[model samples]
Target: MPGERIEGYATDPSALIERLFQQVAERSMVGLPFYRPQLPIKACAFQLLEGQLFGALLTPWMLQLMLLPGPGQRWDYRRADERLALAFPQGEILFRPGEIAPDLYYLSCSLLSPVDPALSAERAVALAENSVRLALSLPVRQTSVINTGRRALLRGALSANKG
Candidate 1:
């Protein structure tokens, strides 16, 4: 089976990285302290790693924004937090604190995508939650499939004696 490749396996390393990034976000957001409202978070920022790489080699900066309904008023994009202003261009409109349309309460997530051809759809949200969490120094739980050294050594010794 040398050189045999499995279908659906990402030949492109970028895709693997992207998938890992998404895993980080998915794991981080579940039962997350800031995730209670389930604000729409999106991947909107991208840093190019290489040019003309198959499927585009890019790293995305994932972000989420919360749009709290304005205090008895319509949404106002112009008044959104200045720090979040650059994340989403439409967010300037979608996340405005006022009413969505005078009666609806809604929020929007703006994202920087690594490979999303269509930018606005929720399906395009890239998973970079881990990068964000790491950058912010947020605590993360780690999991592994490999056995511990003690167990591995014991297993190796047992197999050697058996032979």
Candidate 2:
């Protein structure tokens, strides 16, 4: 059983991300000025779509949007750290690959990184979740022109314009 792998995503990814980053945080990031002790490590709001699993991962050093193959997709583990442009309903997001363990790989798009010390974990989590949800959503209206509001959304901030 130790060598066997489930068809797709058998283990909770939050646990995996937490464990992976926890090691990194403790090992290489302790004295870094950007590391936020209050931010902690967490993975939240993972969603599976069209055989890809994506979610928000928070560590003391950064927050990232993590993407992994769900069921039908397979990424060459050797391609770790290679950047790829992946198509989404919204647009193509650029992802850089990394490893969770031997033969296990994931992709990450940096979100809130070097997290603001003033930012509360609750707020960071909310923003991370919202950013993922918005990133995957199709634009309500297609336009060739890039407006400030839409640009902000594409840049990972929800539109502040309420109207």
Candidate 3:
């Protein structure tokens, strides 16, 4: 919930949609498809976290995540002493490994269906980018990121105490 913000507006959904389309055309290289109610969203809007892209679209329902284009390559975020870092997907991002000191990537939702993390890594950026573009087209009221690192740290401490 770091960069989340809400504002009031009077424009209709369609009008916002048109503006978002125009914005996407101006902001990204991906040629997004026309928006449909049943289609999955695209685009991966990222922000700098400790001098890197720290945020992402982890899932489909998290419509609150910002829309942006992917850099079209993988970014490794581990320190010299660590290989994997705590990470999980919420909305559309994989929380960076350094976010938590212990785990390289924290697991969240089990594979509902077989998910190729590698493939997803590539496709999601596109989907997230599109999704953000679409969401920006609507009358948004709220937004939040899923911080799996924070949650896992609390859980680990509680479990350690119970032991």
lDDT of 2: 0.76
lDDT at 99, model 2: 72
What is the number of residue pairs that collide in model 2? 0
CA deviation > 4 Å runs, candidate 3:
1-43, 47-122, 139-163
Clashes of each: 10, 0, 29
Order the candidate numbers by TM-score, best to worst: 2, 1, 3
Residue lDDT tens for model 2, 91-125: 99888967746544678898767888889978888
TM-score of each candidate structure, all chains considered together = 0.21, 0.74, 0.20
Model 1 clashing residue pairs (backbone): 42-111, 43-111, 43-112, 44-111, 44-112, 45-112, 74-98, 74-99, 75-98, 75-99
Q: Is candidate 1 or candidate 2 better by TM-score?
A: 2
Question: Candidate 1 has what TM-score?
Answer: 0.21
The models' CA-based lDDT, in order, is: 0.35, 0.76, 0.34
Superposed by TM-score, candidate 1 places the C-alpha of residue 122 at a distance from the truth, in angstroms, of 9.5
Taking all chains together, the TM-score of candidate 2 against the true structure is 0.74
Q: Which stretches in model 1 have alpha-carbon errors above 4 Å?
A: 1-78, 81-98, 105-107, 112-115, 118-163
Query: What is candidate 1's CA lDDT for residue 59?
Result: 26
Encode model 3's per-residue lDDT on 96-117: one tens digit a residue.
2222222122112112122233
10 residues in a row with least lDDT, candidate 2 = 1-10
Tell me the tens digit of each residue's lDDT in model 1 across 24-127. Answer: 55766445433322323333332221221111112233343323322233333433343333232112323332222322222334433223433333333333
